[model samples]
Target chain A: MLKIFSTQLAGIFQNIEKSSEEAVEDAARLLAQSLVSDGTVYFHGTDEMMAVAYEGVTGPNAIPSSHFYDEKTALTAMDTVIVSARFAACEKSAAIAGAAREAGTRTIFIGAAEKGTDLDSLPYDVVLDTKAVRGLIPQDDGTRTALPSAICGLYVYQALHITVSEYLEEI
Target chain B: MLKIFSTQLAGIFQNIEKSSEEAVEDAARLLAQSLVSDGTVYFHGTDEMMAVAYEGVTGPNAIPSSHFYDEKTALTAMDTVIVSARFAACEKSAAIAGAAREAGTRTIFIGAAEKGTDLDSLPYDVVLDTKAVRGLIPQDDGTRTALPSAICGLYVYQALHITVSEYLEEI
Candidate 1:
């Protein structure tokens, strides 16, 4: 029983390593640097995905900085937009995408890759495909349940923030 | 200008001091220790309050010996329900609350005052009522906007967890 338990502990650590794929973290740094270098970072959240954004934004942990939203320099120059999967029903996301296009601002969507998706293809300077990371998980009850989505989403947030911090060093 | 800024910070700190309440924390501590000491602790969040829950629950940070919703325990002693205001519209929260009640478990609603709210007729568990936490700030342009609700909400969680940890010492 003792041997089994110890091996089980080691197995968990190995599984965690297998579960982690970080192709998007380095890309996220470029996106952050690009936005900060230019002007503003516009975050688009659908439903509760706002929590991920609230962490990166300055002032009031929940609400994004109004100053960043209001300033013209932030909007026109380096403003990078991040869209979340919760945008399935959120029309506001599409509006932001359209407005960004009209204004020539850069946009990134952490969403699906269905063919011909105009928003999906918008030269996403950094796309941390969270769903693809989820796909890499072994077929199991936990993955099908809320565990994978919940865990991976938080992991993506950490990866992106690390990339953003590195991006700041470049500037 | 600097003096004025110092005064604002002082006021914010004072506001938090005045509003800090702790009876709910005491109650929750006893509650968590009682259940967790035995076997498991179950949570059912209501409404938008689900956001508050996803963090301390099945997420990576919180390690539960076993997932509560995954199976049924035959002990019949497990009971403790955490309700939030946002649960009113959330079916998932409602279902969990219902399950706990049906299983002959105790329930606690960490939200605004209800009819049976005793010990302290507080709206929210001490911190929210006393915390400067998430008030709206007037913009220079004439509009008003909220800071961050989670920042304050997390403060409440911290206070509650501290008390709960102490309660565990007894069990």
Candidate 2:
């Protein structure tokens, strides 16, 4: 079962790499610029996607967005904020992205892009679609298990980290 | 870079599935028993690894171990606690495992098993080694990037979730 899941995940990663490589690189470059300029880089997510925020904040030059209400006071125009949600239309995620945009900071949303939703209309400067595949594995018992969004979100974050590190080196 | 990381992760996942399959199955059975007996299952971790706790608790029949200091009041002998760390020998992780042991509950420790560490000495009923590879990728700047433990830890949790779900089906 794990081998099957791993194979599926490997394919998912390949798809993301092929389609979202430029977006990941561009986001990383922007984040690297913010870090180099002494501007804050904030990470925000709710529920399982919070794993991405935790991973981001623990790394260099990133802060955890614990208090989104205080973003107006804390975030500056030069800063960057990255928000992840299992579903791109998550209310809190949208609110955080809106707040970041209001604060004149760059906002990036990373999550599954849903059709006919406000996800595409959100005030994000950049959006990296996780392309999370749901119900990939069907059990014999007539139930299906969905892939956890945190895994895909973390995969993207890891790629962004590597790209950011590389950009930092060049700058 | 993301493709490279994903390929490495796929191999790591395969290695863990091959080596720790029985351990994962056993741990899942134990967890299932605890849940069936109306015992609480708690998850705890610090830093980025806290994501594991978050993931675990959000699932069925699990609680987040937010306050480890009050384990005596909150946990009983019938309960089970799972703790995750980047290194199995983390001091806080060991302390929590000890406290859970003192509380007379079943304890599990999941993480990378470092050489020369007292991971075997921890008071855990079960130890699921993530087998996270260190220095998996070498960068152009002559520095090696270690595989993120959170990714491996989450992978283990996902497997455990699937196993536990299957076990729940049988009972």
Candidate 3:
């Protein structure tokens, strides 16, 4: 109960990004730059995507600094976008990201580029390649869950924060 | 970024009515309960309160199974609730929560409370009070941006999730 006052910083630091740490870091840098440039970042995800929007899982100091979804909160012309991607099969996000573009915000999609897929043409300025964990996917009460993918996506989000901070010209 | 997800978890873990750790265990339990009940937890937050609507700082694993904001989503009658409080001054939320209460969903508020404040007396079932970290006197940000009260509240929001999960008796 005390964490309502204390534990957030510790909890955020607890789960480290294993394999995809670098990609996440680079993504963070890009995001930070956009933020520093006065561009509010928008995070879009579908199905399990909305999950990322509720909290800023990868902000400096373990804070949920920026993750806009509300139309009222939408960034104006100068905003940048950062989105989480699992597989191309996550087509539900098309409308979501597309709508963001329509709102006059830029777009960036982060996910794995499954070999034959043509990822180079997307509107994203940076593509952070995060690979899936080879073996340990999460399953709760006999129900298989997409925890690994979701988990890694979050890490990339944080890494992007770092990268953004690193690239920030002033500080 | 990644912290948003962890922040969700951190908020849960931090806001438990029980001991900090026990609260996390309980919140995690509640998350499992939410899923098993076929209920999609509803998230409503605005401004700085977006932490409730999205992710937190990176590292920890705090991904929710599902959430709500869209009116068209499958949310209905007596599901669950998550709210953020800013000085307890809400107008729109009053109407929304009123309608939601009529629907029978349980509501939870993350805010500051005086020692005698009776959260149980309210329509909501739970209230995670961060004691609203107050400065001896209100100060301007130019003086310093350390509103420990708000930060504490954020941490509480981060903790409650863990407690709910722990309560549900699942992973």
- Chain A TM-score from candidate 3: 0.60
* DockQ for all models: 0.05, 0.51, 0.16
Query: Which portions of model 1 miss their true places by more than 4 Å?
Result: A1-50, A53-171, B1-21, B36-39, B45-48, B58-77, B86-99, B111-134, B140-143
The CAPRI category of model 3 is: incorrect
| Candidate with the greatest TM-score versus the true structure | 2
| lDDT (Cα, tens digit) per residue for candidate 2, span A1-171 | 776777777777788889988888789877876787788887877777777887787632133222232344578887888888877888888888787787788888888886766655888877788777474457788866746577788888887878887787787
Higher DockQ: candidate 2 or 3?
Answer: 2
The worst-scoring run of ten residues by lDDT in candidate 1 chain B lies at B121-130
DockQ result, candidate 2: 0.51
User: Highest DockQ: which candidate?
Assistant: 2
Interface RMSD of each: 13.2, 2.9, 8.9
Q: Looking at candidate 1, what is the lDDT of residue B30?
A: 41
Which lDDT tens digits does candidate 1 get at residues B1-171?
112322342354344334444554555554665457564555433323343354445342232432334335442445454544321233454455556656665544443222333523222222123132332444457854333233333334434444454455566
Cα error, residue A154 of model 1, in Å, equals 13
By TM-score, rank the candidates, best first. Answer: 2, 3, 1
